[model samples]
Target: MLHLRVVCPQGRTADVTGVLRDEPGVAHLVVHPGVAVHPAGDLVEADVARECADDLLGRLADLGIDHDGGITLEQLDTVLSDRADAAEEAAPGDGADAVVWDELINRTGEESRLSLSFLTFLTIACLLAAIGAVTDSPVTVVGAMVLGPEFGPMAAVAVGLVLRRRDLVTRGAVALAAGFPLAMLVTALATLLFDAAGWLTADALDALDQVDFIYEVGPFSLLVALLAGAAGMLSLTSAKSSVLVGVFISVTTVPAAAFASVAAIEGRWSEAGQSVLQLGVNVVGVVVAAALVLLLARSRSRRRGADRALSDG
Candidate 1:
């Protein structure tokens, strides 16, 4: 379930209340007239079933409440009331299967922002990957993938395409465009330092180990990328955070970038090109797969809603 706290102009309270009251998925409604000080409006609160959240939020948006006021949603980890159960039962679909687009968008928006902290994490992750690549350590490659912060922008792109939000698309693209190149440049510079320090020798760079896969983009890479993309999208929408960690560890974006950086520095132009191709394949595959999954989920949700409406009528 989700808890929604709304602040709306005094005149719109009736409209807001009516919308909430009419929805079978909403319960424990409370209204506090003229209670919102900063927004200078009435405060309304309710428990909403997740299955109905997207539609309910859309209705609220149609009222221009978002522009004139505010709405915030919080997940109710433990709702002890029978009322909450009733709300869930009254909703058309299963709560666990619901998209809860507002929550999804908000979460990804925060995650996808290109902040200094994000850049720092990306840089550090790429550096680790570069070291791992030069050493041909599969364990270190996996660690670098886990540490990378590239998934946020990938998810943002998916959500942007799903919602037709150009701002999100632009922001996501900008983040990727800036973040990857920055990570690559930093990794390259760090590789030079490692080479100068004699820690990364030509023999180490040419080691016949896991690093070979990083620079060998092939059909198998495409297949793996497609699978990872689907799983990543499922993890995000289903709130399966543990599964998301697995998804992060399974992708090759970080390793590919790092491998490309190190390979270029070592004058392995062909290997660098292949590594870049691997990165591009994974990124493109992920975005395309994620967008498709979201679209399909939303379509199913809408169909279920339509069926419920017909039955009710």
Candidate 2:
């Protein structure tokens, strides 16, 4: 279930309440009139079934509540009310399978921003991967994968494409476009320093047979990317943050970036080309797969909504 706190203008409180009351998936509705001070209106609270929240929010938006006031949503970790259970039962599909498009779009939008923290994590992850590549350390590579923040923007771009949100798509793409090059550039410089310090030798780079997958683009690489993309979308829609950790570790995104940095630093142009290709293939595959997954999920949710509307009539 999701908890919604809405602020409504004085003139629109009754209409907002009406929308909540009419929604079968909404329960425990409360209205406190003349309580909102900033916008000067009423405060409304309700619990909504996760599966039906997107539609309910759309209805609220249609009522101009979003523009006239504000709507805030939070996922309830635990709901003890019988009414909450009834609301979930009243809605179509399992709560865990719900898309909650509004929530999804908002969450991904924030994650995809080109913020300082995002760049820091990306740069550190790339640097770690570069270290792993030159040292032939699988543990370091895995650690870098665990720390990489690339998936968020990719997922955001995919979801944005499905939702037709140009801002999200542009922000996500810009983050990726700018973030990767900056991270790689930093990693390349770091690699040069490591080489000068005698920590990373040409022999070490050439002898990394175990880490060769980092630079090799193959069919299995795309296959892994496809799986990662599907799993990533599922984790997002289902609100399973833990599942994303596995997705992060399984994909070849950071490793490719790391390999490219080292190869370029060592003047291995062919190997650098291959590594970049690997990075591009993985990113494109994940984006395409995630978009398809979100598209299908939204389509199914719409169809279910249509059927319910007909049955209600």
Candidate 3:
């Protein structure tokens, strides 16, 4: 639920009130006449009955209503009692689970289209990772991982699945599939240039040859991917954006790809293949984990509605 506040010019209060009265998801309408400050006529407060705050905001914007006013959930609950029945009636049932599949596909498509910023960040990340691999410095490798913007698409894919948005899934998948190859090609070119400068060392080549971790993919990596995916999604969905910085470091997608590029440049074919596999594993793991998390969040929301209905009954 969302609380919406509207401030309108004095004469226009009635017009705004009339508009909101007909909106489907709005409840707890209150009109405070003669509430004025400089350039303001009246203040209106209300609660939205739906969970989709973005959709609600769009509707309000279409009505030409200034939504900068603040409303509190507690105040809304105290003012409105009639919406309880309506909210209960709108609750979902078990069959709503199918929406998850649809959302996954939709999100994938949305993530596929790369923005200019995304491309720029990815290129820099791949370059950093390649450098890190050549230097055999874990710190630089982690820095490259943190710099990569791949999680945006991964998180979008998860959100699409949870929201049952087929378009998002397609976009996300396209972005992920395209992004890696682009990063790989650029990194490969950079690696070759670096190697030509005689900067590639034997130790770096040996580091790439150590392929034990790639084949050892098991529950630990999966768990880390899952946690990182969940954190990434939460950061995207919530106001707490700083947390996503850590999430970028927790996943191995960029680092592994960098390793692969470095290995290829040094003529370590077997190790390059292993690094490729590691990158693939991380990508798949994060996507799958994010999908699951979104599914769970949606299910929990549905269950809350059901429980509220039972209590009201």
Candidate 4:
């Protein structure tokens, strides 16, 4: 379920309330007239079933309330009312399966920012992965994979493509374009420094039998990337953090980037090129798979909403 807060102007109050009243997926609808001073309107609040939230928000958007007033949507962690249960039951689909576009876009938009923290996390994750590559440490490689923040921007790219929002697409693309190269460059420099300081060695790189998959673009790499990308997007929409972590661990993006930088620094040109190719393949697979997943989910949800409307009519 989600909690909705709306500021409705005096002139459009009746129309807004009428829409709210007609929505069976709304629960505990409350309207306090002349309560909003800043927007100079009434304050209306309600709990909307998650499955119906996108549709309800779309209807409200069409009413021009967003221009004259405002709408706030929030996740409800706990809703004890029987009305909440009834609202979910009456809704077209399950809340757990709902794709709240507004929430998703907002989340991915913020996460995709090329902020300092984003760069720092990616850099640290790659450094960790580089170390793992030299030591043949699978655990360290997994940690780097989990620590990498690239998934959010990748998801933003897919979301932008599906929605045809150029701003989102541009933001995500810029982040990826600037972020990976910068991180890899830094890691490559660091690799040389560490090698000079006797921290990393050529013998260790040669003895790497466990984590060689980092540089190898095997037959299953793209397939796993496709599966992980779809699962990652679903986890994002469904609020499944545990599943999302698994998705993060399942992809070889961070490992490939880290190994590419390390291998290049050590003059392993062929391995470096292959690692770069693996990175590109994984990224392309994820973006394409996730975009397809979002497209299907959006179509199915809209179709169900339309079917429910026909039944109601």
Candidate 5:
């Protein structure tokens, strides 16, 4: 359920109220006249079902209530009508709300910075990829994928584009562009150290060359990234965020990045190019898919407002 608080001009209260009263999925209407000081108008409060929120908002906009005031929807998790029902049933509005855009971007930025804090995770991802290449272990490759943190910025870029948020786009691009090169440089240094310690040899480098998956870039990989990106955005928008953890592992962005780093470390230019191409494919696919998702979400919101207006009429 969604609770909406609407403020409108004094003369517009009746029209807004009438609209809200007729809208489907709305109940428990309360009108407080001449309560708003900012717009100096009346306030209409009501509880609406989740499915009807968008439509209700649209109707309200059509009624011109949004011009005089604002509408806010608070999700209610539980509903207890009878006062006595409260003893057995916990009241609604108890659960923490979904994370919004500000929180998501802030968290992503923090994670990106943390990932760059030490070269350890980057190095480990690259080492794992290298080992995966030598041993041809899909499991090890997946582990490298999970360990890499390249998706945050890629997602950020998509979010930025859809929202027209230049700052987010800039930050996201910087993080992604810097992240791969930084990882590659660190992995290269690590390779040198390992060689000096006799932990890496020409045979290991040759084994990396034999790995075939890195060079295989096609439409299939792009499709996977697109799907993964959509899933990722859905996970972000949903109340259940635990699903995103799995999404983080499902996308090959990080693994490809790790591969690129490993290839650079081994001085395999052709493999490095393949890895870079893979990274590009995944990034582009996710960004395009995510942008589409956000666009659709915004369009739904607009349609919901239109429905609200029709209800008012």
Candidate 6:
């Protein structure tokens, strides 16, 4: 369930309340009249079923509530009221399966931003993978995979493409374009420093065979990326963090970037090229698969909504 709070103008409170009262998926509706200071109208709140969130919001949008006031949504972990249960029962699908488009886009938009934390995490993950490549440490490589933050922006890119949100697509692409190269450059410089210290060298890399898969791009690589990407987007839309963690660990993108940087630092141009190719293949597979999954999910949602509307009429 979602908790929706609306700040309405003095003149439009009735229209906002009417929509809230009419939505079958709403429960525990509350209206505090003349309470809003900034918007200067009324404060209205409701508990809404997840399956009906988008439809309810759309109706409110049609009323121009979005422009005249503000709407805020929050997910409720537990709704103890019988009315809440009834509203959920009245909804068409499981709350866990519902995709609140606004929520999804907002979340991706924030995560896809080109921020300091993003660059820091990506660079650290890449450096860890580079260390793993030089020392042939599978555990470290796996750790790098789990730590990589590349999926968020790429997921945003896919979501933006499917939803036709140009801002999201551009921001996501710019983040990726700038983030990866910066991380790789940092990782390469770190690798060079380590090599100069005689801690790890090209010979150590030569002896490292366990992490070779990072540079090995094959059909299975794309297949795995496709599967992981689909699962990742599903996890995000469904609010399943456990499933998302598995998705993070399933791809070789971070490892490939790390290995490519380390290989170039050691003057192994051929392996670096192969690692670059592997990274590209994985990225393409993920974005394409994620977009396809979102497209299918949206289509299904529209059909289900149409059918429900017809039945309601």
Over 1-313, each residue of candidate 4 has an lDDT whose tens digit, in order, gives 8899999898888888888888889999999999999989999999999888888888899999999999999888899999989988988778888998988999999999999999999999999999888888899999999999999889999999999988888888898888899899999999989999998876668888999998888879999999999999998888776898998898998889999999888888888999999999999999999999999999998798789779879
Per-residue accuracy of model 6 over 126-168 as CA lDDT, tens digit each: 9999888787889999999999899999999999999999999
Please provide, for model 3 over 1-313, each residue's C-alpha lDDT reduced to its tens digit, 9 standing for 90 to 100.
4466776677666767776675655666788886857445678887754343333444455656544332222213343466844642453332222122222333444445687777778888988977776665667777888888888777766666766766666667777787788888899888878768878754556554333343235677778887887776655444345888898888888877777777777777877887787777788788887777667766775675578559759
Q: Rate the local accuracy (lDDT) of all candidates.
A: 0.87, 0.90, 0.66, 0.90, 0.68, 0.90
Local distance difference test, candidate 4: 0.90
Candidate 5 minimal-lDDT segment of 10 residues: 87-96
- Give the range where candidate 4 is weakest over 10 consecutive residues by summed lDDT: 199-208
What's the number of clashes in each of the models? 0, 0, 35, 0, 10, 0
lDDT of 1 at 264: 89
What RMSD does each model have against the real structure?
1.7, 1.2, 8.0, 1.3, 7.2, 1.2
Give one digit per residue, the lDDT tens place, for model 5 in 176-251.
Answer: 7776777767666766787788876656656543346655687788888898888877766554557666776667
Stretches off by above 4 angstroms in model 3 are: 1-113, 201-203, 207-219, 310-313
Using lDDT as the yardstick, the better of models 1 and 3 is 1
| Residue 60 in model 6: lDDT | 85
- The 10-residue segment of model 6 with minimum total lDDT is 200-209
Looking at candidate 3, the ten consecutive residues that score lowest on lDDT are 94-103
Backbone clashes, candidate 6: 0
User: Candidate 6, overall lDDT?
Assistant: 0.90
Error of 2 at 39 (Å): 0.6
Question: Using alpha carbons, what is the TM-score of model 1?
Answer: 0.94
